[model samples]
Target: MEDDIYHVVREPEFTALFLLGADDLVETVEDVDAELRLPDGTRWSASFMTLGAVETVMNRWRETGEYGGGVFFRCSDLVIVPKGGVPAMIEAFRAIVADGPQETLGNLG
Candidate 1:
């Protein structure tokens, strides 16, 4: 699968930084049947109700390279070292970010 063809990296550091900043501003990850708290006082008691979206999205990128709806820019950052042609790279990218029920990640519903 493209998972092997493309060695993608979402940069946990970047995600951490981004989410953490949002946490600082918004202050919580609500709707998990409970409040999902981030480090410190960032409470998820409100906003971002679709926690499943989180797992769904993160796993989606793992399966394909682009992340659903093409929101994840990191896929573009990944290199096909040894310089696999652009078509192969694009194919691999699409393979990673396709929209569907991911097997290992399970259904969002």
Candidate 2:
């Protein structure tokens, strides 16, 4: 259920995005050489590459008719679920986006 949280956070030079499916967790982190690390242990390698690769992954899964009951979203640079999944993932994304990183959770670092 927790694995339903698909996210990708990065600074200016790198991008890392992951997708959570009903039966699988597909993830991608590009620019692995730029040396930027997010709290989730994902790192951005460079400054130009984007989460576009992440989109590609999501699109692939969406095209597959097999994964039919998962939540779905295209968060900033991350894509999450399709059809249906744990509700907590949505709440988590909201909390993380609205309060955790920008103006609140000073300790999420």
Candidate 3:
């Protein structure tokens, strides 16, 4: 099996500062349902709900300054590092956000 790779689809001028700023704007919970461990031994975890919610907040903040909601993680706290490359991480997070809790969790009837 191969690890999934996601590419950042944002504007070409997007910089690390923008991603860092978005990271600073997030709030993570103490518990997480899913996690990804990096090659460096660091772990990243969060529920489908939390990831989706934070993605919404980040998108809003990026497009407009009308962001007033909070971002959080469920199973574990949300931590945004440039591991796996900043763009790849950002894109993966975006995909997770787009999938949302219900879809990601496969809550289909």
The Cα local distance difference test for each model comes to 0.30, 0.36, 0.36
Q: What's the distance in Å from true for residue 52, model 2?
A: 1.7
* TM-score for each candidate, following the candidate numbering: 0.18, 0.22, 0.22
| Ranking of all candidate structures by their lDDT, best first | 3, 2, 1
**Model 3: per-residue Cα lDDT at residue 7:** 17
Q: Could you give the candidate ranking by TM-score, starting with the highest?
A: 2, 3, 1
For candidate 2, what is the TM-score?
Answer: 0.22
Instruction: List CA RMSD, all candidates.
Output: 19.2, 13.3, 14.1
TM-score of 3: 0.22
Point to the candidate with the largest TM-score: 2
Give one digit per residue, the lDDT tens place, for model 3 in 22-108.
233223322123343333333334332334445655676666655343233232334433332344444554555445533333221
User: Which runs of model 1 end up more than 4 angstroms from their true locations?
Assistant: 1-49, 67-109
Model 2 over residues 1-109: C-alpha lDDT tens digits?
Answer: 3223544434343333334334433233331211234546543222212345445545667777424422353333232333222232333344444443333222223
Candidate 1 lDDT over 1-109, as tens digits, reads 5334322223222101112222222223322121222223332221122335454666677677655544553321222222222223333333333431131112213
Q: How well does candidate 3 match the true structure, expressed as C-alpha RMSD? A: 14.1
